[model samples]
Structures are given as structure tokens and as C-alpha cells.
Target: MYTLAIDLGGTKLSAALIGEKHDITQRRELPTPASASPQSLEYALAELTGHYQGKAHRVAVASTGIIANGVLTALNPDNLGGLNHFPLQACLEKLTGLPCLVLNDAQAAAWAEYCLLSDRFRHVTFITVSTGVGGGSVIAGRLLTGPHHFAGHIGHIQADPHGPICGCGRTGCVEAIASGRAIAAGAKHDLRGKDARAIFARAEQGHLQARQLIARSAEAIAQLSASLKALLDTECIVLGGSIGLAPGYREQVEELLTRLPPAFHLPVYPARYRHDAGLMGAALWCEYCAT
Candidate 1:
């Protein structure tokens, strides 16, 4: 079966046609609407799928929001403005006239990561530190979506009581400290207004302020990883997304993890699928469900 796999992120929308064996083809991408509203999302989806009218038999979506009973609502409203209560699955089904499945982007990515090492560990966690931090957990070989489909929303966990407020209205959320957005926002002096990538580049060149900003993000992630160890005892934590995979970033996080007690220092690995985790994960999940 051909699956029309789509990944809806904070900054972009991507779609691909996936063959039965999970090969991707005809992938396309577009910037997410500046003002993310229900109407804008509908328009975007239309434009994204316009060319593949008859190319797929089903649709699978990995999206940046809490997806419950086919409705999409943001845990952090600022990430997806005016997208609260959007009928995501219904809209996709209507748009494509195909069966549809929707899952949280992080959750889907975690499932993909889990599948890669299912023989090694029955418990796994995946964290993606991108524009905003996101995460998911798998325990006893089962993905935990929770009753509200919010089980893996780990980025909202508090990192500092006095830190800047998160888009989710929480103070000191891991997302506010550990995400790419946070890294960029934490810049000072000569690094002002630079994005996370630029800051990382500066850090490589031994820029003090840039290094400090990256270190701050890494520290938050290390703490978060330790907390996950205490809570889930996950065999390993897989880090993905732009910031998570950035050069030297994982090393920084690992070094900080070494500071904690031995029990909190779990093994950390980079995601295998990289940028395609969400798209491939959504496709894999839909296939599994259909079987």
C-alpha cells in the first residue's frame, strides 16, 4: 500500500509517498503558515497534496500538537497559533478521500526509534530538541499515548522555577531552556538575534557567550534525561531534531549526565532516521495499525 505520510511541524510542512516497504518518494516541503490557523492549515494541506491526487491509498500524519479523537490542539498555543481544536484527521481524510491516522510528531518519532532497537530494549524514550522540545516514551514494548494522548509531552517538565515562561504557559519548562528556540533566545552580547545554528557555529569558534548558551541547553537536557531515568528507567534515550543532532551537542549533554549519580546516567544515542523520523514513523504506525 502506498501511504501519504505527512509531518506537520512548527516551521514547516512536509509530505512524502511511502511504498509498502517504507521507501520514500516524491517528497515535498513548504514553510508552515506564519499565522497557523485552521483555514491556513487547510490551505497548506491542499497545496501539499495537490500533485499526488491518486498516488497513495492512505494518509498518516505526524503533527506538532496533542491529537485526541482526531482533533488537534496545542499544548503550547504559541507554536501553532489559532490551531486549537482543529479537525486534523477529518480534514486530511476529506482532502484526500483516504483512510487517515494521526499521531503526535514526537510520539511517532519515538515509535520509529523504538522499532530500530526493539530487540535490544523494551523501554525507550526519544527527545527532539528543535524549535521547541518534544519527547515520547515507550514502556514494555508499548507506545504510551496516555488517556489524553499527552503521555510523552516531556518538554513541559519544569527545568527551572525562575526561568522564562514557556509557550505552554508554564514557567521554566524544559522547552524554555533546552530547545533551539531557547538556545537562540538565550544569546547575549555579540550573539544577539542569531539563530541556534549560528550560535552553534560561534560556539565551535570558541565564542564565550555562544558556548554558554549551548551549554545551558545541554545542561537542561542532561537534567531531563536524568529525570527520565528516575521516572521510567528507560534503557536508553534517543535524541533527534536539529538541535539534538547538532555537532558536539550530544557530547555536551552526555558530559553533564556524567555529573549526576551513576543511576541517572543512562545511555544516549542519536536518532537513526534524522529528519525523516516523523514522516517514516507516521507511515510505520499506520501500517502497523492496519495489520
Candidate 2:
């Protein structure tokens, strides 16, 4: 049997069919709707999955935002643009005529990363620094979803009391300082108006301003890591997403982390599945729930 795995992110929407052996095929990608409305998302999903209607036995979704009771609520309205408070599992089931399971993207990714190192560590923390900063944690071998399904919305943690205001209406959230969006938003002068990817390229080309911007993001991420270490004492930290895995980005984070005391130090590694972490994690979680 194959699981139809879908990842709904701030930047893109992707779907793939995964076999029992975990071989992925028929992968497809589409830019997420410019507008984050329920209708927009549903239409996009229909177009993205129409070709695979009956190809899978079930559907598994990993979506950005807070997923509670199968509904998605953007913690930072800026991240997801305040998607409608509708039941996502219900929508997917209606769309595909199959049972569906929905999970927070980072939580799903965390499960996928933990599965890769389950033998080595039982406590793992996964953070993604993409369109927005988000996280998931595995404590003693279990994914912590919390009672309200808001356990891993770590991106909203305050990074600077005086930092930029977040979409969540909070001041100085880590997401406001360390995310790809944040990087792009922080650009000025020669780097102004450039997207995160462009900014990163400029940073690599030795643009002092670009480099400084990314370094600031990395520093915020490092501080977030320190806080996580103190709070959870996680065995390891798994970093993912575009910015997190960009060339030298993880090293930058690690370098900043090294400046701190020993207790704050932990293995900071790129996600094993890379961009596919959320997809694979959703599939694995779907099967795990089935049994």
C-alpha cells in the first residue's frame, strides 16, 4: 500500500506517493496559493492531488501552523496568513475519499529525524528556519504535541524584546529575527528588496551587508538553541529548511553556539531527509497510527 503524503508549507505545497518500503514516486510540487484562504488552499490541493485520487490507501499531511483536532491555525498570522479554522483532515478526506491524518509540519519532521537516530538518542529537538522559524521535540522517544497541539510552536519564543514585531502581534519573536522571511525583511540598502535566497547568494559573494544579516539570523538561532538546551536538555538539535541547510548556515549557527558555555552545546546537524523530512514523517506517522 502507498501513503499519499502531502506537505503544506508557507512557500510551497508538495505531494508524493510512498510505498510500504518507503520508496517515493510520482512526486509533484506547486507554489502555495498567493492568498492563504481556505478556498485557495482547497483548490490548490485539488489540483495537486487530482492525478493521484485512488493511487493511495490513505492520505497524510504535514502542514505549517498549529494543527489541533485536525484543524490548522497559524500561530503567526504572518507565516500562514491566518488560514481558515476548518478541519483539514475532513477536507482531505472529502477531496480524496480516503482517511486522512494531519500533523504540524515540524512535529512530523521531528519524528522523521528522530526515527533516523532512535538508536542513538531518545530526546531530539528539530528546528526549521525557512519561511518562518518553527520546531518540534521528541522527549524520551515520544513526539510532544501537547494537549492543544501547540507544543512545538517554538518559533514564537521571544528573541529580543526590542526586535521587530511578529505577525502574531508579539514583539521580538524568534520567527521575527531568525526566519528566512526575517532575513529578507532585515535587508537594507544594497540588499534591500532581495528575497532570502538572493540575500544568501549575496552573502556568499562576500557582500558585507548580506553576510551581516545572515549572521544576525544565525545568532538568534543560536540563542534559541541555548534556550532549548536549558529547557529540554535535548540530546541533539536537528536543523532543517532552506536557510538552516544553506551552505555554511549550520556552521554559522554552530560557531555562534560554541561561544556559549559547555552546557549549551549539543550536536547541531542538518536533517537527514533534508526537504523530504516532513513528507516522510507524515507517511511514517500515518502508518504508525494505523497499527
Candidate 3:
């Protein structure tokens, strides 16, 4: 059976039609509407769903928000504030006339990568270091979601209690120091451009300030992975997202990680499905729900 997958990110809403083999047949993306209400985001998703009406047997969604108790909370960018306590599954089912499954973006990404790389490792940790740092795990082929459905919310793990303030108002969280947003902010003074790619490019070109900013960000991520390794002893840690997969960034992250305590040593790899991990993961969830 075919599945419809929707990935609701902070900046965009992407939808795709997927077959059982996990190949995407059709896809579309649109800017997420700027509103704080769940209704607003739902309207955008509803419009996108119309494009795939009757084309798939099931629907699944991966969203960038805190999901708990069957409700979506902590919609970021301040544009999706209305999503708090939103009945996302019910609303989508009503709009599309199909069964709907919702999973946190990080969990969906973990499942996608696990499906592709489980053969290489028995236990895996999937970390996405983008606008925010988020992560998930697959232990013995089972998705690891905690009681609150916030199991993979690793971005808030306190790294430095006095470093930088995160959007969540926490001090020195991993995301505050290592995410794409953090990288951009840290390089804003030396980098003339306002984009992450621009800052990364400058760092690649050996710009001293930009290089230091990138190194610092990479260090935070490596240290976090090291901590995870010491705790979970996972076989592999997979890195994805815009910043994590950047050409030179991964090497730098590895270098920093290698300098950590030997007890935290573990292999780190880039995500197999760098760009489409979320969509594929959402589709995987559709199959999971069907059974």
C-alpha cells in the first residue's frame, strides 16, 4: 500500500507520496504559515494533503514540536503557538478522511535511519543538529520513545550551565551551543552573511573567527555524543541535519569527539537519508501503524 507522509518543520511543510518500498512518487513543499495557532498550521497541512487526495492508503506526520499525552506543545519559531494541546491526529483524519499517525520529528528520523543502517549496528542513536539539536534511538530494532513521548528531546540536555541561553530559556543546553542557530549566532560577528551555509563556508575557507565558532559548536555536539556513549554504550551515533552533514563539519566533530575521555569512544556516522530522513520515517510509521 502507498502512504502519504507530511513533515512539518519550523520553516516549511513538506508532503510526499510513498510506496511500500519507501520510494517517493510525488512530493511538494510550502513555507509554513506564520501564525501561533495550531489551526493555522493545520490549514497549511490540509491544503497540502489536498494535493495527494486519494493517492495513498495511509497518512503519517513528523512534526517539530513537543508531543505529549496525545497533544502537541512547544511549537517553535513562535509561529505555531496555537499547536499547544492540539489534537493533531484527529484534525488530520478529519481533513483527509484517512487514518493519521503523528510522531516527533527526531523519532521519525531515527526510525528512518534505523531502517537503512540497522544491519551495521545493533543499537543506534540518531541525532539531528539543525535549527535545534534533537535525537532518537533504536534499540534492538525498537523505537525508544519514553513515557512523555519526549524521549528524543536531547537538545535541552544541559551542556554548560552558564554558556548560552537557549530559546527554551535554559542556559547552556546542547542546542544553545551546537545547533545551526547557535552556529549562525556565534559566527554572526565575523560572517557578513546571515545564513548557516555562509558561515560554514567562511569557516571552510579558514576564516579565523568563523573557524573558532564552528569548532566550538562542533565541540559541544561531540561532547554530547561522548556523554551519550558513556551512558548508553550504543553501537553507533548517526548525525544528520543541515549543519551536522556539512562537508568539513563532520570531520571536525569526529576530531573533537576523539579528544574526549576514552571511555566515551564510539563510532560516529552521517545520516544515510540526509535530506529525506523525516519523510521516509513518517512513511515507515504509516506501515507501523497499519500493523
**lDDT scores of the candidates, listed in order:** 0.91, 0.90, 0.82
Model 1 per-residue lDDT at 110: 98
Q: Candidate 2, residues 1-291: lDDT per residue as tens digits?
A: 999999998779999999999988999999999977889888999998898987999999998878988998766555566475757889889999998999999999999999899999999999989888888999998899999999888889999999999888999999999998899999989888999999999988899999999999999999999999999999889999889999999999998898999989988999989889889999998888888
lDDT of 3: 0.82
lDDT of 1 at 37: 78
Clashing pairs in 3: 35-79, 36-81, 36-82, 37-82, 38-82
- Work out candidate 2's RMSD over C-alphas: 1.8
lDDT of 1: 0.91
Write candidate 1's Cα lDDT for 184-285 as tens digits: 888887888999999989889999888889899999999999999999999999999899999988888988999998989888899999889999999998
> Considering every candidate listed, which one attains the maximal TM-score?
1
Superposed by TM-score, candidate 3 places the C-alpha of residue 41 at a distance from the truth, in angstroms, of 2.4
Ranking by lDDT: 1, 2, 3
